[model samples]
Target: MSKVRVAVIGCGSISKHRHIPEYADNSNVELVAFVDPVIERAEEYAAKHGGKAYADYETMLAEVKPDAVSVCTPNYLHAPMSIAAANAGAHVLVEKPMAVTDEEAAAMNEAAAKNGVKLMVGHNQRLMPPHVKAKQILDSGVLGKVLTFRTSFGHPGPDGWSIDGAGSWFFRKNEAIMGAMGDLGVHKSDLIRYLLSDEVSEVAAFIATIDKPGDVDDNANVIVRMKSGAIGSLVASWTYYKGEDNSTVLWCEKGVMKIGTHPEDQVIVELRDGSVEKHKVGEISTNTKQLSSGIVDAFIDSIINDTVPAISGEEGRKSLKVILSAFESQATGQFIKVN
Candidate 1:
């Protein structure tokens, strides 16, 4: 098949750091257009990446009609932009925390199915080597049935990562909605579900905005009950002053598994039989390295092969439901059922 024509709908840090670069490197992809409210930003990326710059995404979508489009805009814009891209006859790959609410997420999924276009979410944690191995191990029953889990994903904050320092859209309640829970919590929710092959059934949470000078939450501590009768603790923070702490530990019937926690190994497996194994899974993307995500390549390949994306819109919605339900749990001071 000929190269897949692609457009990037947001020229933010994520697009510049991951999406644009990965798509450019893929021999099967042709960058066709770049869109950003700040037209100059789009122009800069277009000049370097071989695409036209547009201040308006609708205009670009109508004109270019790309085969695929990546939506890397603020949290609030994810659903509308993805639905628009699908409606314009383009497959969509959108950033995570798919939408702020279940209704919006459902709309996105419906739009994609209606248009016969695939929709994938950028839940990059699922693409990590160690996490992938953990899934395999769990499926093999080597760890037996997972009984409990503790997972955390934290960093200084998006002020340092987003293109607009301090005043980034991530700090805006209107745009980002739930802050740390939506930003980092959603990732852990998705990873836990993926690792155990279970859905989050209920959540009781203490979501707060501590230390971060914003109305949105900077800290989220949640207790979750999975459909498989497994319980877990999930913590997402923006006040990890020391550095990032992306880690998860699962306690199973026969053994324990550690991911992204230890210094030497990416995954550490210890069994009751006094046997231990260390897996040197490759490094995942960091701020300094900003390594390729492999998401763009997967999206392009799924289109070429005429298959559904591994992280489909429906899957993305399920993950979003976990976070949104956490917020509701915090507000009600009780466990919120994830439906």
Candidate 2:
């Protein structure tokens, strides 16, 4: 079988940790180009993966003309890069948050639809084994009624991920519209939606610069009303010292499920029957990489077999709506409706 040709834009930590290795080692994909503004970085990436590299995404698009591209740039560039890739006749799998704004996300979605191509967002949290299992259990109705969930993702700061600690693009409000919430909080928001098989319709949030001392907020707490009348909460901070975990817990009338530790770990599902089911999955974790690969495989296979990906672009948009509304709620000091 001929593998689908893939070009990866923004050769950064994410692409390096997740997409690059997945593509390079996968038999169904051919990694053809690495795009990065930093020439040496691109070259280094290409060298490591045995693929060509380009300093410009446009140049790579025009030259390699890959079947698909992974837009792994910072928050600001997701829309433009995805739109450009779609225009160039390539399927686009954009990194999370989709875009800083709903307007940008809409434009990118429109562009992909206009080009008649697949447009997928990289919300890899949904692909985690525990999450997948949670969805299955939810669908099976074993949990009875879901009450709420507590989900959070936190770290010391952005020094490890961003190129320049507090001075990086993440710190720049203009370059990146929001901070920790948009970065880490959005993921949890999406996961909650995905796991519960519901949508967040209303959100009331509080955001502050409790740590890192900047205009961008480092910590946030949000109250959300899901479409199913399930009330939920999310808190994410980059200021947490001693490596706090990225964990999600779902509380139902009959049971509860928890994934990850304070900063990171396995998954545990507890049922009302006084039984516990533990599932531990790990393989190059990032933004929940197990879920990342699982969803990637599903997306690629769906394309090849003429099926639908478990998580569609529209599905992703639904999650984004909740995330954006949370931000609006924080800014307005009131509940923001998803509709």
Best candidate, TM-score-wise?
Answer: 1
What value of lDDT does candidate 2 attain over all alpha carbons? 0.78
TM-score of model 2 vs. true structure: 0.91
What's the number of clashes in each of the models? Answer: 0, 7
Write one digit per residue (lDDT tens) for candidate 1, span 85-150: 999999999999889899999999999999999999999889888888888888999999999999
Q: Candidate 2's residue-wise lDDT over 1-339, tens digit each?
A: 688898989887777777787777667987888998887878987887767989999889998999988888878898888999999999888878788778888888789789987888777777766667667877788777889888888877676666555567777777777888878887788888777767788889888888676577888888888889988788989887775667777898889877775233366668989998766555225532323465566657766775655665676677777778877887788889887
TM-scores for the candidates: 0.98, 0.91
Q: Which residue pairs in candidate 2 collide?
A: 127-291, 128-291, 244-262, 244-263, 245-262, 245-263, 246-263
What alpha-carbon RMSD in Å does predicted model 1 have with respect to the real structure? 0.9
